[model samples]
Target: MSLLTALEDGVAVLTLNRPEVHNAFDDALIAALTRAYESAIADPAVRAILLAANGASFCSGGDLNWMRRMAGYSHDENLADAEKLGRLMQIIDTAPKPTLARVHGSAFAGAIGLIACSDIAVAVPEAEFAVTEVRIGLIPAVISPYLVRAMGVRQARRYFLTAERFSAEAARTLGLIHEVVPAADLDTAIARHLKALKAASPAALKATKALVAAVDQPLSEAVIADTARRIADQRASADGREGLSAFLEKRKPNWGQA
Candidate 1:
């Protein structure tokens, strides 16, 4: 299997299993990932997700073998192929559940997109990152939106043009990754994040994600009205009421008890 999945204690871990290729993506892997994500999203038991890999490198972007096949495709064929990748990124980015990336070694090209789509990313101090599409005479077109959002336009301009490799610390400083820790502490860091995520009401977490995405858009009068309506709706929700009641009673929320 190119992808591995496990659900435990409300956390679903999706592990890239193609270590021989440094977890490089191909059509099969892409399809598998889409399915895995869909399954996790549909399963109410899953409260959080961890995107991880089994290899020296997290993901090397595209598989060389797959690229060779794409080289022979016509323009239309390539466009269709690119669309599949875009859809995969969209699925990860729009997932309602809290998503985290367990990044180690190196994450390049499309792999960077996966990290960017994640709500939080944790990397080891020795990890490396790059937007390397330019070196092969190709552009990082598909992943550009999420990459720019995560790193900002200014940083994207420099790295996208240079395709230069950078350290994990540089990635964190640029806002692409949330935390950098020693290799030995990677799991500990991820666990901490999972613990925090699991403590929140699942419904509220989903609404919160949507809230942020909506706020990031141009704030027109209609958008402002919609935001106000959403908060009001949440305030009347069962989970919301229980949360407030729990706080006043000096007890843990129902969601946290699980």
Candidate 2:
């Protein structure tokens, strides 16, 4: 299996199993990831997702063999291939459940997109990152939207063009990663985040993720009115009513009890 999945305590841990290639993605791996994500989203028991890998490197981007095969393909064939990868990124980015990237070692080229698409990313201090496609005569086109949103266009422009390896500290400053900890503490850090996620109402968490994506778009009158309606709807929801009543009664919310 290119990917390993386990569900425990409301968290679905998706582990990249191809240590031989530093967990680099190929067509098979991409397909496996898409299925894993869909399965997790469809599982009611899963409250959060932890994306991890089994080797020293988090992910080194595209598999070398996959690239070699792409080199001889016609333009249309290549476009089709790229679309599959883009679809995988889109599914994870817009997933209703909270997603976290547990990054270590190096995350390069397309791998950076996975981290950027996640709601939160935690990396070891010694981890390295790069947008290295430019160095190899290709562009990070598919991952551009998520990268730009995570790192801002100014920073994305420099890294995407330069293809230089950056430290985790720099990545944190650029908003690519949320926290940088020692390697030994990576699992603990992820656990902390998962605990917090599990405590929140699942419906509210999904709504919040949607809200962020919506707010990022141009704020027109329609957008404003839509947001107002969403909040009003939430306030009148069963979970919302229970949350308010629980607070007033000095008791844990029903969702938290689970």
Candidate 3:
């Protein structure tokens, strides 16, 4: 299988295992990833997710044959297929649990969407990236939401228009990679983040993530009031009180207690 899912110690790791093709996505890979993400969401035991790939490259984006297949499909079929990819990206984007993209190498086209949807990304400095769609005569409409969100309209305009290759450093500068580490130390860097995540409360992490999604970058008064309401609710909740008490008393809150 090109995709594999495993859960251990409250962390779910989904590996894109198609090294022969740099984990380029096909319909099957898309379906497998969707199922794996859904399973992680359904399983309360899963507190975090790590997206990594086997091979010298993280992902090559759309498979050529798959693109050919889509090129020949009807418009309606293409729309439906696009929806699947969009849904998978959205699921990962809103997964409640934290998501980390472990990119050791290049990520292009649709493949980059996965990274953009993640909460944190740790990539090797040498890892390359590109929009890689205009070169093939297709617009990156499907991946636009995540890609634009990650790189913003200004950066997106340059890359999406040029479809030019850029280094991982450029990606990091554009707010894509959270940290760009040496290739040999990529996994170690990601592990450090995972370790810190593991020490935090899963429920608190989930709620915090939800809050971020719900109220990031908005300066509207309504949003401010709504955020305050949420904070007040958390302050009075069992988890909230326990977390506060633990901090003040210098003790760890029992996992189930909050």
Cα lDDT, all candidates: 0.82, 0.81, 0.79
Full ranking by TM-score: 1, 2, 3
Q: Total backbone clashes of model 1?
A: 0
Clash tally, candidates in order: 0, 0, 0
Backbone clashes in model 3, listed as residue pairs = none
lDDT for model 2: 0.81
The 10-residue segment of model 1 with minimum total lDDT is 218-227
Angstrom error at residue 84, model 2: 0.7
lDDT digits (tens) for residues 66-165 of candidate 3 = 7656544554566567667767877888888899999977799888889988999988878999997544445566567667777889999999899899
TM-score for model 2? 0.83
Model 2 error, position 141 (Å): 0.2
Q: Arrange candidates, best lDDT first.
A: 1, 2, 3
lDDT of candidate 2 over 32-74, digit per residue (tens): 9999998999999999988999988999998867765655555
Top candidate on lDDT is 1
